[model samples]
Target: MERNIYMNTITVSEFSEDQNLIFNRVKKTGIPVIIMDKGTRLAEIHPPSLPEKQSRKFGCMKDRLKIVGDIISPASDEKDWEVLKY
Candidate 1:
């Protein structure tokens, strides 16, 4: 996981102490601020910027057949399936 330390942070109790400063930082800095309790992470503060770009490897639904093509295939010299019935 990516660890971003430049983001602001505050204890759970500090958040209750000054709501304005926390709100302002989130608005102006546009960075996340974590709320902690007893050194354990409790909550995060940040606004999502934009959706992630779609991967080019998968392309679109039109490539369904191509995906199936990548699946591993059985050996061409394999014995007949009738042996499986026994």
Candidate 2:
């Protein structure tokens, strides 16, 4: 299981006192800031995830790959097999 990660935990009162600094840090680091209240988790402040790259989709490299004829055929004859030689 993945563990919860944060720059650090802060109480609600402390967070309220330094919210701007905390927010700026979270945005710059791209990590979460866990806010707690009375020893329990209340909320989290985090930066938004980056947009997905379009180049990762299937067939994105189709134009870059070149296949010659008879791709399904074997490159060598069956008589050349090591097991057959024995």
Candidate 3:
């Protein structure tokens, strides 16, 4: 089932006059507010949603990744690595 949420709509003048009140209301209640200017929507103000906590799963990408070459050995000869000595 899909649920629809309604947002409170207000004019620019009202928001401009009572910025703190409107902002506090939005923060207290999770509902968002639509700011309209001359009957057209100009902006929206809402509180940020909390991020969901996620657990790390080991080996989740097993077999999905490819190893092109030998990982245990260096790609080039030992003499070529002397460039970093400085």
What are the TM-scores, per candidate, against the unseen true structure? 0.45, 0.51, 0.51
What tens-digit string does per-residue lDDT give for candidate 1 at 1-86? Answer: 01323347677778877767777767777888888889899998886577899777665667465454535776443556666657
lDDT of 2 by residue, 14-75 (tens): 78777778888789887788988999999988798889876668877878988878889777
Residues 30-52 of candidate 3 have per-residue lDDT tens digits of 78989889999999998988999
Cα lDDT listed for each candidate? 0.69, 0.77, 0.77
- State the local distance difference test value for candidate 1: 0.69
Off by over 4 Å in 1: 1-7, 48-86
Scored by lDDT, model 2 comes in at 0.77
Q: Which candidate is the best by TM-score?
A: 3
Better by TM-score, candidate 2 or 1: 2
Model 2 lDDT, residue 80, Cα: 85
Clashing pairs in 2: none
- Candidate 2 is scored at a TM of 0.51
Q: For every candidate structure, what is the RMSD over all alpha carbons to the true structure, in angstroms?
A: 10.8, 9.3, 11.2
lDDT of 1 at 19: 64
